[model samples]
Target: MNIEFKKNKLSIALSIALLTNLSLMAEEKSPKELDSVTVIGNENSDYKSKEKVKLNRTKMDIEDTAKSIQSFNENFIEDSQLQNIENIITMSSNTVYNGDNHGRTNDISMRGFSGVPILIDGLKVTNKMAHPEVYNFESIEIQKGPDSLQYGESSPGGIVNLVKKKPTKETLGKIELEVSDNSSYTPKLDVAGSLNKEESLYFRLVSVLKYDEGWTNSNTETNKVFIAPSLSYDVNDNHTLTFMAEYTDETTPSSFGTYVNSKGNLVAPIKNTISNPDEEFEKTQKIIGFDLDSTFDTWNSNFRYRYIDYEGDNGNVHMPQSYNEATNIVSRAFASQKQEFEEHALQYTLNKEIDILEFKNKISLGADYNKAYSKLDMFYDPSTPYLINLSHPSYEHLTSASEHSGVMDMSSDKTYVESWGTFLQDSIYLTNNLIFNAGVRYSESKPKNGQRSDALTPSFGLVYHFSDQTSIYTNYSESFTPNSQEDTSGNILDPEEGKGYEIGIKQKLFDDNLNLTAAIFKIEKENIAELDPDDPTLSKYKASGKQESRGFELDINGNITPNWSIVASYGYTDTKNKDNNNLDLKNIPEHTANIFTSYYLTSFGLPNTYIGGGAKYLGSRYADENNKIKFDSEIIYNATVGYKKGRWRANLSVQNLTDEEYVDGALSSNARGTRVYVGTPRTLLATISYSF
Candidate 1:
């Protein structure tokens, strides 16, 4: 792996040298057709695009929003073959896959915090533990920092929004088949067109089937089936309604991953080997939603409602003690549980534009309400023996881990949690080049057996444009989440609170074909609940906890020349637990970066041919809270070559071309122990598609 990395590094240097000499060649190409070279999408140029409504619940350009945001469109998704959220984060700056990747949740972490929620079409549809397929969505949007004013009660890191594909009046669709080197097969179908002759109604249907036979020792197999159907109706010139439904069923192996030996390497007898290949889990998930949009002379409004349900049963194997180097063995135990979850949510927004004494103003008001319930039952027996050997394993011994004596051994009991929030924001243009923004939200949460808590959060921002292509901005925001913890008397503790501040400058050049943004930010939190220092078994709570984080991020996107397109970013973050110097957050790389670029080869008599590659670098990160064990830094390189002509396209992509061994996820210490999931090796994916 080390030799491969060195070779790739040399290649990267040579590629840069070649790019530096392409200026003369770029100047000779026809500029007229440059507009047809789409990178993100067809809506706007590579440097500047349409306003994002998720920022302030109103249409506002990126320069006027005074916050950090990143977006990936259809073109990028297809070119990169980003099948899941984990794949997206690998190329995303300052982001880490915090989740264990247990085939359940797409848990992401940024700026040292974890479990940021994922929203679908502006509505919170599922909890943090669900990982939905991305093929059904048209684009992905990420809003960094505290966004509680727009989306309520989330980690200060940020939020992700998946924009679903809507029904189009024009008849258009595509069918695609994909195959990978990992013994995976996938077939997909998508079609959208007018449902009525008048073109007032439209519908779209998408379905996909996949089967993946994973690595050898990992003992993991995943099979999935997904279907989504949607319909849209145009009631009048100013009103529209859309309905959408999705269903998914999957079966996968359940395990916490492999133990990291004292040498800091994953303990695998050989690649693809699994210590517990027989343990498995099955799950089913469903979602139904609708949206209503209306535009009036004075204002525009939108309403969304969704319901989600999930059921699954999983068997887990836990290794408590560290692996003995001499014996090459680790002691482990097994358990099984059945769980269910259901949630319903509704959201509404109203936007108005008005002129106040020569100042143009945009105001938005919104509300969100949601209720969730979950239940779990576990099978256990004191008499059952549970143990396994790493070098030598057997399913017969593992069966003893799920023993039950006629009745369920334990349960989490039935629990219900409800939350709601209301917010109002105003963006006032004090002058043609100056803008001021202010917003506030009132949020509350109620537990089935604890006291309800509510609070008010606020935010403010200012932007000054120097010209059509340059601007400077600053902002401050606050966030809060009610704690579910209770003392001996059964009273809820205070809610966690966060305050953040940011300042940045943005610029565009070469007719808005190149975009650059740089920002520095700081966040502080209070009222963080934690366990009593004196007691480890009999737990006690304290609200007097503190944490602080500071960081700087730089992002560049769009085209450098008529035929050259690029997306790149760099991030530096420092985080600390103020009250406890011994603890640090896990899986957060202090320095991370990504850069990918593609150039159309119109000069070599191959007008539709293109080749591109990029590198991702991650700094060393700790696996345990105490920072005793650390994973070394790594750099992975990838390349792609493809051709597009008329309506047909074919591409071959190689990820981790160097076959670098790395760790992408680490489970923090608990009763079980610390274990890490090995990163994927060099893999190849080939895709072909035709669109009408």
Candidate 2:
């Protein structure tokens, strides 16, 4: 027989044997309910989440986990009307909104580290150029510090995991429409139901369409379409499979926001843009994946696979090079790029619980493999200088690749990366009050054009429970990230390494409805790729730099009363470049705070009505590595009123209640002046939703 045929024959034989065994086992076992689907909504629709699934590759109570984990459920996302992942960062601790990189990347800084990885479920998203849509996700989980044991080759700062909505056993449907003051309209649909009377097979479909006119004077319109469908099948009482697919197509302005002059003052109005009218970014992403869960006599196993295809086109982007404040003229260069990325990932995990030496031990073992290929085609028009008078900007003279013609420089390249890892973990219940956890992972990364790197990372933790409602924990973890930069000698540098230490306390009050946590952490990173001080040309880099970040964070979430819910966070971060005379890191705020609370009007005889308001404070931050330019602290306020009766719900939200003028993020600074992102002005959004 042919090799391919032989493989297929073997697969079929294995499937048949497995089914036969399951059938025999079913005949001998008693009838039981099928495994429950993961639910995102908490009891009473509260803001707090009781458990996290991605942290350990298994659902576990947050109080029992040694790491610092924060969860925002669907209720919070709906109440806040979060549009994307960037909005969720504001409510998190020790995080900075680093602006979407001209609507091309999810630029964010977590715990003083930039470029944190984003995951769907437990798998990494290879393409980071597009922002993740929030409508399809049921919850967002932020895992602080190094989590390399579960996720390989990630920034030590943290990882963000988006939990997707799953098929429900009961028939349900929801329709919603939203209108914003900025001439934006959105319609969304969500439906889920069981396919059979036995409820063993189920399906869900979610979709959203949005159109928004330009918010600024420039032609910065936005359009988006997203659809996701999923299915869940129970092969038997001991096995389950879930299939998921997603499609997204979106276009948004590739705006650089406002600019700052030499005197550190904003040069343009909040609603004005310096970008060309025709500049825009477009992206289309598609994903298909499946998960298999199995329970054997002695262990439980999970297998997952995902394939992703992404394409992005960034139109002509104007990059300011130099600004003459006295002449009121800004010189810029133009560039356009198109990227294509495809990725395939596979993961398998097994878990078992047993007693060793009379001590209860939960052991977990897993392996994962990921392969990705990317191609980039770029065109630059640096030879043709494009100058614009900021005092009276005109788009007629804007330069694009088509305009430059023969003067443009073109380049194309293709690259691929293959990575694999295996991890083992054990959680030991030493006693009723004390628990110990240990894990180790061995990972390897091989790039098509770069050197191969491998590492063995370890994590250790201890948790002590004072009572059922209070606990204290400490953890130490290490992270490894392969480096692609090269020195002047054209040699790839060694991988970056990180070490993190944290201690925290957790408390539950109000009958476990309210959860509070406080943590202090220190992170040390080495082998950072930085500009070679010796390389005067600024074209080479060296990986000899080191950095450190130490911080304290406090988070509170849940209900103060049956009718009152609150979510609050505060962080104090101190970061320094150990190799650069202890200079403060750019855009890393020293103090950040947020608080949002809502109260139902049940006492006022309107149980269906609620009023909520909150404020976000971003502390002073430096715009550059030299710390010569600083941005003052700013506080923005927001409010919302919501009412629901029967199957109908309505909400009105007002953002930037005071029309605060502030810098949301600093992208970069140079002789051309500072490229800063401005905060959104006062805006209103109204939403009406119906459920059946």
Candidate 3:
């Protein structure tokens, strides 16, 4: 097979290419063809376990994909101890985290912008940055760089996807109960069983409950619930069908602690650690989705339906102002905010493998329909309008490290939005070792009080493999986002749009035990819809929407040896306004790196023991676009010691082990003054777990 992809191709040529290749698009299996069919048959022979078997895909199998993709399994998550989607940034080399926002708020930078899409089990999830629950996932796949053909009107940064666990013929399950030093308790139960009586049917179920008092001296508790059920049936020895559904709900408070000083240094917020169980801020989210599939001797088909409801509210709790000592001020302020977002999507796919031109080839065709609706209500009305004279404890919003409370607007904040899109894509394996992929999309978005636009975006990509251990790939993507809410004075801004290109190479070694990847990427943003400075023309400004970002990356993750595993990354990024030439992208550091590793002490002495440590480093960054000032970069270190014997385990971990003071994030909106938040300092956590 020889796969050569031209940049521009008429629809007629692609149709003809597919119509003329019967053996490669149909499911009819012949003796000689059975040896090379790439669907779900012979490939199953690669490993003793399904986890390993799933990683055997070569470059030719995915070269035609519409986006740049990377896949990881349970071992990857377990080895990294990823908490949720929020922690995924630490797991992927191409990702950078802007703030902890205490999980209440999240800002991401890929290429150079935010607002990328998320997917579950291959279906679009939500574009909002809120982290989704991760209790029932088997693996995760990231499709980045370019994606206009498969998903409509998306940000050029890329896509994040989570693959659900399916029912298998084997009965497997785990029940775990863990307690941490922060007064956090989590109990989880997961079970998968085969319907032996049906021979071809299997089922799986999972549930979890978590509560934490938190690292803050203020008493707080967080909880989550997740349930996923799946059923898979073998229609025959060569075909199988599966059905699955997932649901999750959770809430966490917004601990808006700030940091800042007049001399441009960091400061801690004055807080009340007392127990006020009734005063706090929070967020709640829920998601539901299902998928269907059919397979034949040579081809496989699938249908997916996904629906999600995400809503959150942040109010009440008194948040601190900037932590700057020089600009120290305690003001009476209040904010009441609420958001509601909904998504529904449907998709269909067809894939097959065949021999042609003296070579074996693979093909994929798919179409998708997506609809999204959202609305947010926001209001900020301060009680003590001006910073109270801190020297005077009786002044408004000014008290000791404990006594301070003010009124926040409770009735004036409310807003809403709605949007939708459709997309299609195709992948053709022109040769046994090379792949080509292309896609296109159209979308229409309408907000309650803003302009609406219908957009079309196209994408392309290519992948070349040297062997099962290494591959090289490149891709292009585009996206659009609208800014709806507005201040008084009958004023509004335009929407934001992003575009970018990425190229990289990946290597897998040690019998699939170690993986390494490196890539260079560039992303740009235009029509940013910012405020006019020169003319203050409200709606007209030349440099308002101009911005660009460029960077290079190196990342590696996997077992150094059977008992030693690690994940590490280093990135250099630079973002600026193309028009103004004097502004810097806030929160995006010029340098970032993280290294985490673990080793089983049992390899030398004990059979069920481990020791681990890691560190995360963020370089100095701007808190505003002007780049007039900077926040010192800081490094956070962690260490852990644990042992597992039979069905029981225990461990002690120290976070910020060196007590290295660090700021998780910083920002300045609608003001000349900057604001920042220092992440936790030195803290210790201990955990004990058991399974029956």
Q: In terms of TM-score, which candidate is strongest?
A: 2
lDDT of 2 by residue, 99-200 (tens): 776766777777888778888887876774456778888888888887688778888888888788888787666777788999877777787889998989
Candidate of highest lDDT: 2
How far residue 121's Cα lies from its native spot in candidate 3, in Å, is 3.0
Across 1-692, the per-residue lDDT of candidate 1 in tens digits comes to: 66434533443454344334333433454866334333212321232234364534665778798887777666666666656766665455577775555556777877667767778887775553455677887777777777689878877877777787788787665666678998876667677778788889999988777667765554556777788999999999899999999898776666456666554566654353333566667788888989899999879999989888888778654323344545555554445677888999999999999998878899999999999888887755434343455556544435544354543367799898899999999999999899999999999888787689987999899999999999999999988878877655556788888888999998987778777888899988788888756555557677888877789988777778766777788988887878778266677888989887776787687777777777888788888766767888888888888777765677888888898988776865443455677666888988876554
Model 3 lowest lDDT segment of ten: 40-49
Report lDDT per candidate: 0.73, 0.81, 0.58
Using TM-score as the measure, name the better of candidate 1 and candidate 2. 2
Root-mean-square deviation of candidate 1: 9.2
Ranking by lDDT: 2, 1, 3
**Candidate 1 ranges with C-alpha deviation above 4 Å:** 1-56, 126-129, 218-220, 269-275, 315-327, 381-385, 389-408, 534-537, 582-584, 670-672
What is residue 534's positional error in candidate 1, in angstroms?
A: 5.5
Query: Global lDDT for candidate 2?
Result: 0.81
How do the predictions measure up, each by TM-score?
Answer: 0.88, 0.91, 0.78
> For model 1, what is the C-alpha lDDT against the true structure?
0.73
lDDT: which is higher, 1 or 2?
Answer: 2
